[model samples]
Target: MHKIEELKIWKKSIKLTMLVYQLITALPSNEKYGLISQIKRSSVSIPSNIAEGAGRNSNKEFKHFLSIANGSAYELHTQLILTIELGLISKEKVQPVLDLITEVQKMNYSFQKSLETKISILNTQS
Candidate 1:
């Protein structure tokens, strides 16, 4: 089985999750169950899905989970934009996390493509 912790995308997603939590703390208490909750869940899903996918036995399964994680990344990205628009946090404070999310998205996309290639090769050989 692959080591999820060793994956660069996993590590970066973890970092993004951490930054999201930190940033959320500064938001108003009224948002505790609103944008705050949604943001936190989506942020956490990115890494959690990656780890879960890594534990799967097949490349196809892993790739499927990566797609889910990618979706969560986009969801989080949208929520982050909403937070900025709502004035929950300053752009400067959230920029680093946004940047990290973009990096994770790119890495996830590349990794998924690599897995697809591997799967295609296996299919051809069979």
Candidate 2:
């Protein structure tokens, strides 16, 4: 029941990952193992870590995973910035991805805070 599968964050992460993949595929062949690979890894990690964290038995564990997911989101954001800077992707394309990154970051932080509160409550109860 504590799984992120039930979370709006997880849902949006899934959508964002798909979009990231699609965008990367359009990248030039020269970036295949560079920007493209990094983008894919960072994008996929967001949702993967979120789900992994959700599967943990404790709120602390879940929060740890969400933290990892947040890191991945930041990593993805950096890659987006680089892509724009390198002229691989246009400024317009950059904004939407950046927007999604912002949203994911907020969601991950919210999930982490919620988990922290739950852990605190449990700690107080024991």
> For residues 1-126, what per-residue lDDT tens digits would candidate 2 score against the true structure?
365667899999999998898787767999998888899999999999889877888778888888989999999999988988988888786788789889989978877887788889999999
Candidate 1: give the clashing pairs. Answer: none
Q: Native-vs-model 1 lDDT?
A: 0.93
- Weakest 10 consecutive residues, lDDT, candidate 2? 1-10
lDDT of each: 0.93, 0.87
**Residue 34 lDDT in model 1?**
93
What TM-score should be assigned to candidate 1?
0.97
* Candidate 2 segments exceeding 4 Å error: none
TM-scores, all models, native as reference: 0.97, 0.95
Per-residue lDDT for 1-126 in model 1, tens only?
Answer: 589878988988998999999899989999999999999999999999999999999999999999999999999999988889988889998888889989999999999999999999999999
